[model samples]
Each structure stands twice: as structure tokens, then as C-alpha cells.
Target: MTVTSAASEPGDRRGAFLLLGAIILVWGINWPVMKVGLGSIPPFWFGGLRLLLGSISLFLVAAFRGRLTLPALADWPVVATVGLVQMAGFLALVNIALLHVPAGRSAVLCYTTPLWVAPGAALFLGETLSRRKLAGLALGLAGLLILFEPGSFDWSNRPLLLGNAFLLGAALLWALTILHIRGHRWHGSALDLAPWQQLTGALPLLAVAFLVEGGPDAIDWKWSTLLVLAYNGPIASGFAYWAAVAVTRRLPALTSSLAFLAVPVMGLTASAVALGEHPQPALLLGFLLILIGLVLVEYKPRKPAA
Candidate 1:
């Protein structure tokens, strides 16, 4: 009998990298699209509807592929927990933040997931905090502080302050979700679990959206809005999230997480190009620090075999 390995082959690694790159690119461009779309749609409404569409699409795909399996009852609670923290909490906050902050600024803040993850992993996940990771965490926080001061904190208005707080809450929840998922036993690919989580979590969001936005009748249709929904729902959530899970299975968690550093940088650049937002020098510096931190976090020391 021939034996098969679960580890990805060299060819598979290359494909994973390509898929990861595409995910980053699509998500990068999506930042500006979301900002533009939120101009017309309420933030909660937009997030709820987008997630609803993504859940339906992903569930249909999972059903068709015959790979769908229900999580054990024990697993369902964790799944729901993660869904609320990562999907609902994070998405709603970011969506709301977009209304107050520039897309690029909001993207940078949200992508600070790594900063939170390092500590969370160390404390909760029992992952050893290496010197490199600690340094990287410091560097990332420094960068974030630079970005956060004056710019992110300048909430001259009440909505802006609420938005900023919401974004921070989202980031914290997302970091917690990541830690939980990594520590727990989830029996399928992100493709498999994502649909269930989204479908279930979306129920609350749908209610909130209706309560806040006052129903579908209040939504105005625009071509840009439709484009945002399609991109964020199908391409970004469906495809990008799946690609991330696939890559994480192949690469070390730290390595895959480091790749996320590209998301904010790409988002910032895309915003400048697409939305005509000018880059500030401090923001550029912050981006540099973030990149440096990512590099440090992913740096692996070679082990000599005995």
C-alpha cells in the first residue's frame, strides 16, 4: 500500500504562496472599496449583508464539495465564540471605523493583529515568546503608537471617537479569536468552518443592522456599493480567508501571520492610488516599522541536526 502525507509538497507550497499573494492583493484593494461603499450604506448594515452573502456562498460551495461536516457539539460553542469575536466584533468595528477614519488609517489599525497576537499567544496559547518575536512585538507597537497618535486619536467629533474605540475593540476581539482557534480543535478547513460561523454570527448582525439602519428600504443602491459588496463578500471573505487557512496549514503560524503585514501596506498604497489619499511621512515610517517587525517575527533560526 502506498502512503500519503498530509504535508504539502514543493509544488503545493508554491501554489499556496501564489494564492496567499492573490488574497493579499484582493484584500488590499478592498479597503478603499469598503470606504467608498460605506459612504452610501450604514456600516452595520453593510457588514451584516456582506457577511450574509458570504455565508450563503461558502455554505453552498461546502455542500457541493461533499466536505461539509458538522462540528461536534463541544466544538460548536468555540466556533460560535470565535465567530462572534472575529467575524461580528471585528467586522462591525472596522466598518464603523471606516466612517470616521480614512480607509488606510483604519486598515493599519486593524491589521495590528500581530501586536496583540504575540502577547496572547505567549500568555494563553503557551507558545514560547522568543527574543525575535518580542523584539518584533515592540517594533510593531512602536509603529502603531506613531500611527495612533494625533492621527487616529484626533477624534474631533463624537462619532469619530466611538469609531476609533470600536476599531480597537474589534482588533482585541480578533486577536482573542485567533488565540482561541489555534488552541482548540476545529475539525475542518477554514472553508468548512467559516460558513457555519458566519451564518450563525450573522443572525445577531442582521438584527443590529435592521435596528440601526431601519431595514432594506433605507438602503440606496449604487454601482459602487454593489461592487463593494461583491468584492468584500465573495472575493475577500470567501476566497481570501480560505487561502489564509490553506497557507497556515502549510507554513508555520508565525510565518503565515507575518504575511498579513503586507495587507496594511498594500491597503495604504491602494487607497492613495484609488482614492487619492496622500500618504503622510509618519504613516510611511509606521509602515516601515511594521514591515521590520514582521520580518523579525518570521525569522527562523536553523537547527543543526545531531
Candidate 2:
């Protein structure tokens, strides 16, 4: 299955970095947003509604831009697979984990996506593990370890263990999607299929919600709930997903994976501010390590000979 992005050629680093920053900012805040939504919405229905609204938002934007179209016959399977794993599987897992885990802790575990992506990129995409990238990977993992605070986590507690495992599954599934997207040969730009993939992913969830969770009526409608859902659907999941796909095509897979380390840091920070969760000093140190890791991962050396 071939995944395609908006640009066939490599993208401008400056623009990609700018998109990265925006993705982190919006998605980082989404932790609190999801937490807020879960307050008035059942987890499965909330996840399904988010994808439904997100699909609508993307389709509208693509139509307005005259870029909306169905995926090619050859692309449908890839689209369905990604929709299932990346959207339905990952989100459902994370939502369930969030019910038992703190937003910050869950974010940390999910951001371990890089650990999974790096090896897959090397094996499947044939991306090299450059010295700087290796250093960055090490630094990022170290930072995550510090932030994870394993000694403090109650591994003995069944709920915490289950929540953490759910998050880990989310991370692995997300990594598989990233690897697939990175290797996909283009039949259409990622943006062109965004709505379709989102909708495809939502269908299963919607069915499950109707059968298991009793459908959208299960949602407790409130101003705050509607506001966050709107933000998530249009801005965070819709725009951010497009931007990420475009940027991922431009950057090395390893670099993209390492950069993901920033999201959890931002999520942690936003959760602290919005949810009144106190931050530990390790959080600050983790931020520094991630920045350094990003720098290392992104740095490119000039070729010595042709």
C-alpha cells in the first residue's frame, strides 16, 4: 500500500518545522481537551464523534479547495488499514487508558512511538541510523525514562497497569501507521484521502458505539463539550493530521519520530495549566533533553562524494 502526501517532492524544512510547531501546540493542548470532553461524553462515543466531526471538517476543506476525491482502487486497502489502526484502534485505546491514567502519564507512554518507529523505518524504509539520529534516539529515550518515573508508578495496581498497557498498544499501532504512511507510493495526496480514512475509521467505532455504548445520544451535550469537540475535530485532528502527513513526507522517518517526543512534553505542560496538575522537576529536564534530541535528529551532514 502506498501512502501519498500533498507534495511529491521533499518539503521545505522551514515550513515543515513551522507545521511541527503548530502540530505540537494544538495537539499538545488536546490532552486537556480530550479530558474535558470525556467528562460529558462516554469514551467510545466521544472517540467516534471526534472522528465523525473531523471527517466532516476535512471533507469540507478539501471540497472548498477542489481537492476532494475518492482514493484509487489500489489505495483503498491502505486507507482502510490506516483508518482502522491509526484512527479507530489508537484513539479507542488511548481514550480507555485516559479513563484510568493521568493525562500526563498516558501522553508520556504514547509518545514512546519513536522507539517503535525507528526500527521499522530502518528495516522497511531503509532509512539509515546516522550517528546524530542515534544520539537523538538515545537522548529522547532517556528523557522519556526520566519523565516516566517508573519507580513511582504503581505497577502493582491493576488499573494503572491496564491503562499503561493500553497506552503502549496505542503507541505501537500509531507507529505502524507512521511506517505505512512513510512508505506509501502516492496515488493521491494525504489530504485528498484524509476525510475518507477518517470516515472509514469512524464507521466501525460508530457501529460499536451504537451497539455497545448506545450511540451519540450517550453524549452529555454542554457548551464546553461542544466547544472542545469542535476544536478537536476541525483544528487538532483535521488540520493537524494534514500538516503532519505533509511534513512527514519531507523529513526522515527517524527525525519525525524523534520530534514526536515534543508532543508529550507539551501535553504535560498544558495538562498542568488547564487541569491544575502539578509538574515535577523531571518534566523540565525532559523538555530540555527532547529539544536537544530534535536538534540531533534533524541535523544533516553534507555528502562527501557523489
Models 1 onward score TM values of: 0.90, 0.83
What TM-score does candidate 1 reach?
0.90
Residue 276 in model 1: lDDT: 93
Candidates in order: C-alpha RMSD to true structure: 4.3, 3.6
lDDT agreement of model 1 with the native: 0.76
Model 1 lDDT per residue over 1-306, tens place: 000113443448778788879877988888898999888888788878887888878877888989678866767866687667678777888888888888887777777666777788889878888989999988987886786566556567888778767777877887777677667765554566778887776778889988888988767787877878888787787777667767767765555666767888899999999999997878888868877876776577778998
Give one digit per residue, the lDDT tens place, for model 2 in 1-306: 112323334659889889989988988899988987888887778778888888999899998998888899878867887889988998899998888887876777776665666667888999997777788879977876776578886778898788878998997898898788777665866778889988988888888888987856788888998898899787887888878877778776556655656788889889999999887778667656755765676566667996
- Give me the runs in candidate 2 sitting further than 4 Å from their true place: 1-20, 129-145, 245-261, 282-300, 304-306
- Against the hidden true structure, what lDDT does model 2 obtain? 0.78
Model 2 poorest 10 in a row by lDDT:
1-10
